[model samples]
Target: MPFKPSRRHLHTATYVDNKLYILSGFDDSIGIKGIAGIAGKQFFYLDVSVPFNTQEILWHDLTNINLVPSHIGAGSVKGGTNNNTIVLCGGRYLANAENKASVYTFDTRSNSWSIPTIIGESYIRRRRDLTAIINDDGKIYLFGGSLIGYNIVVNDMLILDTINLSWGKSSTLNAPIPRVYYGADLLPNQTIIYIGGETFVNQSLTLNEVYMYDTINDNWSTKKTSGSIPSNRAGLSAVLGLDGQRVIIFGGYRNNRIISAQDSLYTLNINTFEWTIPKIFGNIPGPRCLHKANLIGNYMVISFGMGYQQSESDILLLDISNNDEYKWVINFNPPISSSSPTSPTSPSSPTQIFAQKSAAAIIGIVIGSLISSILLTVGIFFLYKWTKNRRIQKNETSTSDNYNLQRTSVITATNNYNQSSQGVISTTLTNNKVYNHGRENEEIMKIHDNEDNPINDENIISEVTEIKNHGQESISVNNNQSSSIQNINNINNIDNNVVQYLKDEMIQVVRQEVNQLINSDNSNNNY
Candidate 1:
């Protein structure tokens, strides 16, 4: 009961000239399968400022006119820019051949109905539940309806010129399949968005798709929107707002079962081809199908639905004045003026109005600031930490370059491991290493003076041992002992044996590590 109910089974609604007009639908009527029964073909109007919770709507009984019937009343009660009249177009009469291509008008100033002369070539007979939309240019467009008994549906788009009072069909090319009970709305760019609905086929299949019609190009296109799309349904309510840049849709029925009636609101952006789940708060009206919603000023007046038991007569007014806040304050008052629906002939307290607006603004500002501060703090902290870490990394990298081991120096420090002709020739020929290690009676070593002058080594063997213990490469090499060592080096060569031994060891280590990594990945995958 988040959304209060005022009346039920109200079919079509439209807002024009600061008033909401709700038109004919049914409530509490039993289906007789073969025989037709009476329906609630009543039209009611309310001042846009009235809060919805008020009972006893200043209802003007438009039902007394022998014109409208209770069946499937599709289309809208559109108003012209400079005109005071509201127009209603083709829908079924719910009873006999009464379902004709009938057009009617409501003069707001006089608060009465005037049945207009039918303008179409052949009257749209036996059709029910079509879509009607009025563009900014003051022309009304009607799309898609069905002949009830024959089950024939038409996809032709028709226009009713408000200025000329004449009807014309679009000469523009191919169109979508003829469908009825589909949700439709006009975008600011004059593109018509059509959502899922039942087809004209014998089977009542619920479609999950979206199509758009361009009024200018006379072309149709499809859209693949993200997030949830409402299930295929008939009798759902759709309106263009959140300020004409977006569209909001609600409640519908499928298979005679009511679904998607939650207070959830979905939005679509015209410029970006993106859909959004806007945050809505406060009281949300429950889902009900066969109801019509009209945008009056800053709110939507939703009236009468057949989704619930007892065919509700609840007239719910939804105030979406704050689109950024994404909240809807609903009042379930009977048909009344928008300004004072709850209080009859009473003015809102001035102090209360000021306090409410002031509190809302304060709350919005506080929430906005908190979110901003959280995001700003996170960004600043990360930036500071990143800068500090980057500086440390640069310092570490510079130090390593000046101090870490170079491959050439490391090899030179290992005595070049060349003590024979074979070792000497391998080093000179390929610059490759042999891994054999051995003790030698004679070893070559030289030293440099503090002034960087080459100094002769007094004892080659001892000097070489000292350099080996340093664990760092020595550049010193003996010039005098080179000839003497060359004779012994040829006899002591073991290059091939050392090279084979090292290769085997390296291969073993690489195979072991690769096996370990693969095993680890497999275990993680299993877990």
Candidate 2:
């Protein structure tokens, strides 16, 4: 009786090698003067095989052997190669705060405590009221905890490989709501079922809504459960049944009162997620909340909780060997499964792994498509600007070429006019003969630079020649006629304006001669 554990709640009980190993917990109320709650130092267990009736029913106190750190509300998972290991981490408050998430491990075989070397980045040190479960591969999955400060994070699913001793995060999306004070356990396949928890707001949420976490693929989903769902509860303990297919749920904090006298026992089928109450008989334990339950062979042994009118050191066992007839028992005949019921993580389990990875691949494809579209838009914008600039440059070059060609055409026309001056080109002449040029003619002097000059410094003799030849094209015919205009008036039926060269004296002489020829045609119809 000297080794018996005092009245305590928030302690941890883990089954290892047929022994119920009980660890640190809080003795007083957690809310007594802020964070001033007494942490229990006693660490012991009862070899469940021999208990109560025999002298062998005694607590093996390992309290004085090696000083174990006191912790309250710490998450502990039973694991290891031989399955005699308990990995404990985080708490409402740990006595040793320096290396909070060093993740202490206890070997029940040697009864030793040691911190394994962590390989990679763990991100956060410690958290309170977090849920932890170890898979068959010895990887501990930590999720849903209360944060210590801004630095200490337990937010995303944290993973710790117990074998290699490495730390990492799941980085999984669509996680469950952040909660505390919940009971979580593996359900047959590496699929974990977590139920009965409170939010950060201190409001007790309904236990009807449960979430299944797939540890293999790192994802969370809500499994459809039917048949008499439990009410809103907290401080409830959910232990996997001895049958290995159902979760046995027991006493919880219900409607402002602790479930003490009136016992609550329900069975949730892990495969179907359906809840069913098994028949009960024979002195069910009364007035307990925030307790830990472990299935040993044919009995459901619950220990260490806030219980009234009962010795904390006393044993409470419910015999569940008979499927429908579950009665309280002091001792068990033989333990059901050799393996821990909580450790459902086996070699072939969790079929939910592959489907989630396919979804991740789809997300990756969408991200790649978005990046490609951005690059395409940028390329098209640059190409359009380049085309517009090139077109403007081409237009300017074309205008320059046209100007050069027009100037070259005007120069060629002026040279042709000088060459054709010798021939009496029969063409009409008028005051509208000036060429309308769009550009400034820098070579205007070229027009006046012709070899055959239209006018010299002084030349009135050429004007007389033009007046004497006005009557006829032949000089002999017009020489006798002194008055060249009078003979030209006798001519008829002639309407031709002919220019020999640019040497037509001031143009007035030619105009007057032409007027005389027109008057002759009108005056005398007869030639």
Candidate 3:
């Protein structure tokens, strides 16, 4: 039982739950162009759980539940907290009319589609052939796409907050050149990596540069890749590996008319920024462009695309579970009806042979350069760490010196206070002792002549009592001075400890920033 979709292109497919939803695209078989090109209104889905050869392998049409008109090249994303919702926005339906900025949503749980009210003051322009990626924060990011009616590509980045059902332009700076039909994939670190796309500049040349958008920081950076670089192409399909460490790019068109529907497959290691063509066994799909690749478990399912001679309806699968080897299998082949187009023969020309050899050489060079770059990056990182550590040590030393100075000042103040209080106590004690001795002598002599000197004895006794009270006050002042000196020493010690703790915290923060910088650098290289 062969299941096939109508010959179409410029469509979008998204995998949700266990099904792949194939949306509107231009159907050349219909040969009908009203305002826009011949576009299909039917919505089809396939149960991926069933084997491809099984009779159950068929696409179920859900167009009755869909209300929106047919469209092509719409930006879509599967988002929401549960990832059960698919939102499509901004596509072209009629060539003469303005591009559709209307937003539509499909609930996977209910199998229903509905238009959602967009609430925002910012004008959301209608675009087609745009790329949209969903972040972990439930926001869909739309990148460069063409303004259909105007025939202009825009570089504006828009963000749709799913939680609020609102749209706003992102404040990302230094974005890539405005282009369409680019290959894009999101990394685990919330960065969107965009590969080659066709730009209108220089008479519509394909771009080979790689650009990365940091979703967290709202910044863009260019990555320089070394290796057998793939030819500048657009309409390529990129799928991230299950481990989230590699991106596999397949089938794209090189010049305006040249389609790269061959056996060549490129794999990029995100960690090392390396590209390698893995040896694939079994039947390989023909060269094609504008295809969709979906990673399901250990298998990669590539759907319909424009092949070398005609539009392809076959589903190709590549088993990547084995790291050492890959097995390619054609999962589904559509039934050959009279309406099916015949496959054209692909001849290998001398130019093609030379191109292949050149590509191989480039791959060799890229591998060599990638290794060197990795080594250099590692070395630079270690050097940076060493420099940071040295700086931290110097800062700690300076802080310690400051702490010692502060402690010394506090100790000096305490010593001065102690000396002054001791001097005052000594003077008061001497005066009290001298006065008490004189009074005591006088009182003792008066006691001998008690009958004649009663009034003199009483005066001497009062003077002696007053001297003793003065001595007690002097002792109390000395005790207070000792306690104050102890407190000053304690405070000085606490201040020193606080300074040390602050220095440590500063060093920790510096280390953290350095680590973040290194990680960012590594990620950019992969982009």
Candidate 4:
């Protein structure tokens, strides 16, 4: 009980149900079957709920207790939705056939290990050394890392639904390219932040991009970052701040060396997407990489990682937590508990009432605003349609009336026309006419329609020809012209009696056309 797990770099640890569960990692150790030397039952847990000093702290070693077969680490670690299960997925193989066993879980309640019956994990064996996180909905999201048995990093993202015990691939829009050894942390808003990592070429190179994933919408986004941002590096460690609005990142490898402690400490404001070198005052921990930082309240518990040979950079066992009073301590303290009274006699305070009322008001405002927006949009759309129809009708009426009225001048010398107010009309004619034989006069008549000619309005019926006569020229003149031409005694003039008969026949034709037009207009209006 006095001894602790061996110092290791590539191990995995996470807090669940007030217990910190540790998993397998790489160290100076031998392996079985020529597999991972870092693989073994290097797994353990510490009850952080109980108070203890570092000197007397007990590490519950699960190394021998119902040993998990193919126990491996440096994979993704997340607490289950049930809140008691710790899930580990994708890591260096501890067994020769570790491909068949991609998942290993530990049940704290049963004090036992298990490999949950999963359904969709067929190519999951190929995924290795990836980072994992669980959202409130119990979905485990795994991101960038090297593929199993291969040195190249992958660009793939896989999701494990903890509720259904199934695996699926993420179809992300604009996801980040393949990389590995990056630092990642999940925000309370179900967003994941991926910090600097490296991708392989002839050798590994730093990936400076900051990738953000929105789990709700299944999209990836990158935003502009400002402030004193740290230089791009990989193999760093990131932990969410206790405030739930920021993330603190620690040392990583950069420029072929561990980043110095002086430039190692930085904070990212999740709300603002800004970075800053936080002020610290104490024995600063040495520069390191591939480490893990766990936030326990006001202090960050930084674990083991690789370091430089300089004495200042030789050790990384320090608490850079508060960023205000940085220190190296062997003390473990319980977080201050704020317990509310559960007495039945306890009355609700004014503050609580006000908060409830304020919440109700905000919700009401949001719902009301949404409904109003929809109604306003609908109203505008319908109004536009109605106005368009009305305009169309008015144009059609104007065109019919204008051309119809102008046509009166073509038919008679007095130039008179009449109709009802509607677009379809009934016309009355005032008869007055005079004609001279010396003048060459012709009139073109056309009927207009409401088609796509609102500007020039050329949508018209074929032109009507002015009547002229050589064999029947007598009917071509007006009534007075016809009467006056009958007295003329010329060799070209037709017999007087024949001219009279022709004039009478022409009048009859004119009368029939007028009656037909009036009937057509009446029929249109009725229709």
Top-lDDT candidate index = 3
* Residues 264-305, model 4: lDDT tens digits: 878888888888767676556567777677776456766656
The better candidate by TM-score, 1 or 3, is: 3
Alpha-carbon TM-score of each model against the true structure: 0.55, 0.59, 0.59, 0.58
Instruction: Assess the local accuracy of residue 464 in candidate 4 as a C-alpha lDDT between 0 and 100.
Output: 19
TM-score of 3: 0.59
After superposition, candidate 2 runs with Cα above 4 Å error: 29-36, 51-57, 94-101, 150-155, 260-263, 311-314, 334-527
What is candidate 2's lDDT per residue for 314-340, written digit by digit as tens? Answer: 457777777676887665554544454
Model 4: how far residue 251 lies from native, Å: 1.6
Question: What C-alpha lDDT do the candidate models reach, one value each?
Answer: 0.56, 0.62, 0.64, 0.61
By the lDDT metric, which is better: model 3 or model 4?
3
TM value for model 4:
0.58
Model 1 lDDT at residue 444: 27
Candidate 1 ranges with C-alpha deviation above 4 Å: 1-10, 29-36, 52-58, 69-71, 95-101, 118-120, 123-126, 171-174, 201-208, 309-313, 332-527
Give per-residue lDDT, candidate 3, residue 401. Answer: 60
The C-alpha RMSD of each candidate to the native structure, in angstroms, is: 25.2, 32.6, 28.0, 23.5
Q: Is candidate 1 or candidate 3 better by lDDT?
A: 3
